[model samples]
Target: MESSLLTCKKKISKKCHVPRIGTSLSHFEPKKRLIVGTKPNIPDLNLELPSDSEEEEKDASDDVPKLLNELEVEIFARVSCFEYWKLQFLNKQFSQLLKSGEIFKVKRERELVKPYVLMLTSGNSRWTMVDKSFKNFRRLPEVPSDICFLYCDKETISAGTQLIVVGKEVESIVVWRYELELHKWTKGPSMITPRVMYGSASHGTDAFFAGGIKFVEKGIPKVCTEAEKYNANTKTWTMICEMHKRRKFCSGCFLRGKIYVIGGRYENGKNLTCGESYDEVKNSWTLIPNMLKDITFKSSQSPPLIAVVNDNLYLLETSSNELRVYDVNENAWKRQGVVPVKANEASGWGVAFKSIGDRLLVIGASPLPRSFIKRMAVYTCRPSPYVEEQVWEETENCYDGVELSNFIHNCCVMFA
Candidate 1:
């Protein structure tokens, strides 16, 4: 265990000054509440960073350049996802650049993006929004789902978002759409093939739900090869091709332009080592060349969390609590870095993970002497071969008031 990153959160007194944007230790915890901020909240999607006091401004100017050009702003904007949200407070110029989507445009053109984690944790089954600091949190509507079936985060460059939520309902699987921009929930088309614990991934504009254990008897079930695709725009689902292997409690990731269905267990209490990819152009599924067997260096009770970052596939091995990177071009696996110890300790039940911008965001719990504490860990994923150079920053003691049994159902990262 790394004691350097694990410690109690410091509580601030009344009338304390706000910390600077991008400050690592900016998180503040009060008596029974987690403060989002003492500053004014953003009315719309165009959020402004907290204002700096005069003395703080003087200190910043003395240490760093006062003015930033467009290129400099772009460079700073690409640095941190949570911090990037706070950087909007730097100046009027910085505020305008972010509000006008100029910074995001530069990032998209340069292939740079900052991801914000939208997580679903089980405290009475509620939702909350937090910035990079992870100290401040705002409550949102609960996603109307019982069993986590399929969930995904999608964003539009114009500044809005949606989280597609799906789950099992008695004899069928229900679909619900949560529009982030409107903060409203509406029922969507249900799955043609009702499935639970299925391998799902959203590619392009459609959501795909694949292999899962189909309910036949009261308790005993059978692995399924059936799959379907749901179009968010049309609010309709069209049956798609089946996968090469049947899987349940599996993981799916969209890479390049195809969907890869990774490791999951079947009815025989055995996990599938081989994986496959679906190509819409060919309307078929092709074997992925024993991708899971080649890379699974640890034993995971459930399927590992798989994601695609910068054309490469990354997996979080829950058992070993290590992050591994796989280059699609090289078709080889290598050690990237270890997940934060706090997040690893929380993975005893399961961990929620997603790729935000260039970093990997993980949400898990740290067991304490009396109870458990939920925490979020962020890691920078560099495109370099030197893995040791990467950095991991954690935001612990989040959702402190929530009960520990509120296990994570699902989590996704969205960018506005």
Candidate 2:
């Protein structure tokens, strides 16, 4: 196991500080919580870079003799070290700086040179503005029907490009698009396959689906492990890495442009301790280590929340209240914090939580004072972000009728 990256989280006595807009010095405190979403959290959609070398990290520090007859500076909001490229859309200084390639500023010493615009993603769920600082969290509403699988919609752009895509899933899979700027969900292209209890991971516009059951195998309860892919640019489907084992309720995530799959229930048993990673470039699935738990992810009620921070992969073991981080390069596992309020009977059951950004937000149908109110909870929990990530809602899409129950002249037809 790689001990370097797999150590336990170091809790700070107090928060770190990142200076505000006018400050010249560089200081940053990580966010308080990972944003919550409708269903199972999906992949970390944006850039996941290891800390670069000191020399390479400082490569862009030299001041350019302020160019004469200079191009006007384009203003951007506080976009992180990544997603700085969407600046290309702007005609003025935005285009020039994007071409300059000087803003890959990894150094905390150098504060943001360019600004950023945050696109809030939305679905059927509504936003409950918490406060001014977090922008205010958007709360997820109850699904009219039972959930199958949840996916956080994501897109790819040139490294520094900023494009926010959001869509919560429904019982049925339907073509949908989320306008981050508008903070709304609308229909988009339909999927060729309608899969429930399956998870989707992506690189840019390219997305891949893995391990979900199409139907309950009537008398013989069997789960499906079929893996599929979709290309947003092409608007088509292509199958990719088939997991070493078949599983349902499996969770998939994309980190460093690769797919890292973990903790799913299969027909053979509840949890598949083993891990799988598919390299898009290589077009393959190499089994890593199986989870140490003698019993892994058993009876997963929802797709697991999976994310990567500092290249170490982490996930919320749905059935169990604890979180686990698997360091692929190091071949080791480390246990993390417990989900807050997991013990209370009221706090337990019928809960939904997924990782968004650096935080983990949870929503559960809770029994409240006088009446049962569906409450939402947010926590600035876990270690460094393994990667930029978002939560997804479980919904139905392209798949047609799950089963056919009809009558023939002299016979009965039942599809399962």
Candidate 3:
């Protein structure tokens, strides 16, 4: 019996023998191996583990509640203004932070302000506010006023966050302001000398209006040289030194830290080639004679189509549809290139030419074939005074299927 047991034990020991190092185990039946000090082979359960990003987000969500409100505002202030609308919808705290205008104040302190274009096209009583890319736009609330004021010829300019529209009512010339913060229109804070077709310009938080026609006792239009400075924060207008010459239908631009009024007619109905620049330091006007003498004038032309970019003045000559840059030292305009739009068709009536940041923006009816159905074209160019030819690129239309009239009645850029 002992010999038989010994023989069975020997057989079992041989069947369970450990394979030598570097030896093949192919002859053995396939089974998971278990080592003495290591974990046994186990099937994968496919469990999902939290990723680093998800863990970090969880940590931030947990930590946010501990931050103070002032610290929260400081954090939100660094966000882009384009995301503001979305942030306002996050919670009541964020909505109140934006509504209180504290974010904008912080942005101003950090020099993070952005520019928006406010334009009133023909056949449209409401104004359109668009971003620099023209990708996003919203129609402003309609001005609550008489039909005469809505349909009449109006002048628009922006200072700080206020868009001021000046138009003639049945009884008087009135000022209607669109406050961005309030998102509504309010009348009053009328100009000291209410006028139309004036040369207007904006700088920082102030807007300057000068040299337009005003109605007198008999409703007869009389040209004037009076100027006024409007403070957006104070919501008041104070009279400033008058221009050197009485100009009507003039165009104004802020250049080299001064307000320049260019290319308008005198009271005698004769076109004036001279321009004037207002120096805030001296509080006086410097006459720039023969500013427009080199360029030809049309029989009935609109005001000089001018814009300032990088402290340089540019003109869109409507007669020839030519883009010219002013030579400060020579007092002459050097032709840059021919514009794509037909500015001469209506003598620059329907075209919108203005500066947007470092680029010059032009919006008007395309010169494409009529079969194209007269689509409005939007083009922008980064112009350099030294470059002989400017290359203009078309921007994507984002009017949201609204067929806006190509005739832009009022357009202005506001940096807020």
Candidate 4:
């Protein structure tokens, strides 16, 4: 029997794309204003003649200042990413200004861009996204049917507004790219080799995939050593240098322009303590020291989820719900605080972590007395040697039919 038992497996597995409404800022497209013609192309609407006073009021509303001053622009740049998308929809001038990169520049200069954690989980071919606040959510379009049942050992990365997801169905692997600006999901170049439980990381518009099981031969699945990268602009995959060792269920992050693959598991069922860093420019993989040799982890514990914040890598443990910061200067992992919510006893299989702005977003399922519930929370980790107590503030919860099982295969961070 498969580990994941789906309630809608028979009905959904054979179906294809089903359109759904969702939120994505998408690229700047000129809004098509309503045209009032006697014979309209879209004839379904009941067009009525407007009164003279109504027309005059509409003109006055349009005459309201369509542009913002320097100070006003600065103030508007502080709006949250979600609100910014909605504002653009209301005014074409706002859309044009936002697309010009002027607002992002001013925000960067003023240091006002706040990061909000975006959480995603899927079951029965439906993908749902929610922010840390839980007050806002967007139901993404239905996932592709080919890999709809392929729900375990998945990986995700964010390149700008695009969310890249890699997962496998049987021996074949599929790559799905979700465009935040366009609110669309498009297929990308699949890996040359099929694999599961691989490590992935993204920098800019490119992504790297490494170290997973290719396929089962002679009743045993072989761990992979070859690595590949995906170029978002070209929508193609390129082979990269092989790693020094084989790894699966590993944690990865792109820091300082280099790809780092941390601890994973081998075929023998023993966890790997060593790690490796891949230098894309150098076209070589450098073996990193055994950072986990001194640390202790349970037998069932998978590798921690890694996220880059201010050029430093942080790890979020699923077993203990603890956060650790890696100091490259000191070559040690500093103990941080624990997440406010506890994870399900399944060794944190449903938990995920991502670094948004200066805070860390942890999303997962917390085991209750008779059931499990979903939670989205944020925590602040300071850089100073001495820091204050950190708490995970719960923003969202699930009380409906949303499954609390290992539905969330992976989570990632993307800058809007």
Candidate 5:
């Protein structure tokens, strides 16, 4: 006789870009608009998250245990790591699972949701899916797929409350945002210039988009020097000061309200050794000294993931997996830590932490057509040993008028 008892698996495995409609205002390429074509089957409304069925919540004894501890969370999260297994069945069973609230769910707003890190990466443009967070590790695949190897022309996180994703499909920059708690995505205003491979950073509610090359022809594009900004409240974009130089495949992060755009390859396709700073208050860009070591704005597909902690910027070269810190106040760069594993950026740029205090989590994905991982690898900012621990404990010997021994014997069993 064959056994028929159902057993649920723990740590299920995982699986696997842009907006059309951006441009580098400079060069004013008429053909810079990217293709914003839609697929035949893409639903008008795509839904993500598990349903809070009345039945599931009502039963406690029959409830499935939630893996919330850090280690357990990471393990189950690593299962589909880069959306490997996710893409496998996302079409059918996954669809039903999501619709029925079986796969993933949203946190209650009333409950204090512990702040966690969020890292975003869009996969092959053909079926691009946004790989998010190592904590909850969700596969909310709704991004439009355009071509084969589509990349994020640009991306920005709004206080981690929303994801302001703007990118170029072929020429135009398409804009979309993911509302964190709601677990839903909504369309937003597009950029005037469609840019590919640009840098973005936000201060308060206003987001800034800068740099990125615009395609003028099939195989030719020019690095742009234009800068633009978008405000969530106004839902509008305003053009601002352009950079002193043109560069693409660069990275940027906000430090103490200043946007530091750094180290992207020049139009010449050479790694950029120099960087710059942009101040919105002054509406100007200030040229900074060249980095101590050379950093090419090559593709994010490789290394040099830049992130910020306490307004301090740092870079992680995937090629070396060596962590380097850039002290904004000191105006200097120095090595901080090293990653334990070697990360490949072949598919695209590895993810940099936008939320970790100062540690940036770097993740990458290569193809494994035959394996579960069709694309994407997941790794977090190997935590810093130097971070301070301020875990506070509340020692209550007894409630208002209760005795310790009385309560202990009443609620707990003491071993003999």
Candidate 6:
């Protein structure tokens, strides 16, 4: 299975085109600083020169005129994070401020953060970061790992400003993180128990990973129940309590202030209908049996397609292309409506389903007639379980003319 996926990825990469970073503030000409007046040739002999300390103070105040440095940072924090890259070109101070990630910290404290979608499309080695509007996007630097890691099946999740990609190399499983502030990919800070096909979800600066397959002696695969938490701020992973049942190909989400892992097969190759919820304060997992009992299972289908928006858990039924909302109190799923995308195709493979802020975002091949040529379709809807039909709005011209494959290898949303 892994070898076949790697071969498919290799073929896709060959046909992909790496998009250049989009232009920002490029049209406007630089405003030349004006010289109001020339210095006088004759100096007053009695005039006392300013002290070194006084000169330094004056320069510091001039850094942000009429505002203290803290106030300047506060102002910048309120601005959309997508425009932050352009701010670096303003001056060295702005560049330093962005690189320091101080604005992001301020935005978090002030509750001014916004979600940006990061996607690794099929045939594209580099990841693309797109704003919530999907109007502006920039290509991220390619991961610096070897071809083995590059073409292998990978899982992506975002914690704070870090985008973490977990995959297998020739010798071992590797963790590669793309730091938004640094705008670079760095390796290490791997999971406590390195594994793949695990369920992962991010909350604030911390991300949780649980229940994946790990290789034992001589490449023998074994299902694992071990769970771990990754703190992006500290760049560290801490072991958490294991789940009741061992699982692989499970899906995870942060809902109702808890991390929920749902629907994956056990080591014995039997599908699991139960779900588990982890409580950080109690440091335990609560097993919820038949969490996915309503949904039909397929042997060759991808892991459960799920996302959370407004603390409501939603599942995309791949067999029917229908959307269902989980009722926490009732412990059952409520059918919303059919998704516009062709999720049923390929058994939910090559599709990106995620929550972007208040809206549920779905990217895949459109079921519409014009989708015959394989043009990727992007749609978003404000999902409400109370409503019978979901009104999905297609985000036209959002791809910036780049031909992206409908097959999304990995996708995650980073709120920074």
Number of the top-ranking candidate, with lDDT as the measure: 6
Question: In candidate 4, what are the lDDT values of residues 108-201, reduced to their tens digit?
Answer: 5676654444445545355556554545555567656364435455667766456777776554667778865456688766777757688888
Better of 1 and 4 by lDDT: 4
Query: Worst lDDT window (10 residues) for model 1?
Result: 5-14
TM-score of 4: 0.67
lDDT rank order: 6, 3, 4, 1, 5, 2
* Residue 82's lDDT in candidate 1: 48
The residue-by-residue lDDT of candidate 3 on 1-416, one tens digit each, is 33553465455455445543544465222332442336767756796886985454332223333344545566666665556666566677777777677766776787877778889988888898888998888888999999999888998898887899999999999999998765789998899998998999999879999999998888999999999999988999999998889999999999999999998988887899999999988889999999998888876889999999999999999999999999989999999999888788899987899999999999888878876536778899999999998999998878778878777898988876
- Candidate that would win on TM-score: 6
Superposed model 6: Cα runs more than 4 Å off? 1-67, 370-373
Off by over 4 Å in 3: 1-69, 75-90
* C-alpha lDDT values of all predictions: 0.59, 0.42, 0.84, 0.64, 0.49, 0.85
Worst 10 residues of 3 by lDDT: 57-66
lDDT of 5 by residue, 1-416 (tens): 00211111232211001112332334223223322334344444566544675333332222233422222333222233234245435455334433432222222222222333333333222212222332223334565545521443444455324556655565355777755433566665667776767877766556777888776676577899998887754678889999987878767767776887877777777767677788878999988877635432334443236666565666665655566666555666565555433333332243333344333444433223436343333444433424332121111221233211100000000000
- Every model's TM-score: 0.62, 0.49, 0.81, 0.67, 0.54, 0.83
Which ranges of candidate 2 are over 4 A from the true structure? 1-73, 76-133, 137-172, 181-184, 215-222, 231-236, 292-300, 317-320, 329-332, 343-375, 382-416
Q: After superposition, how far is residue 228 of candidate 4 from its true place, in Å?
A: 1.9
Reference-based lDDT, residue 67, model 2: 25
Looking at model 2, which ten-residue stretch has the lowest summed lDDT?
A: 407-416
**Each model's Cα RMSD:** 16.9, 20.4, 18.2, 15.4, 22.9, 13.8
Candidate 1 clashes between residue pairs 3 or more apart in a chain or in different chains? 36-136, 115-357
Query: Model 2: per-residue lDDT, tens digit, 1-416?
Result: 11321231111111112233543333222111222334554556695754654223221212122321121221232343233324355345545654443333222124443222222222332222222123323332332322432334322111122121222354444443432222344454554544555655655446677775554434334466667776643456677657777776566777766887766677765666676778877878877665434324334244455655545566655445555676555666556655542313322223434334444444332223524332323343546434233332222212132211110001000000
Predicted structure 2: lDDT: 0.42
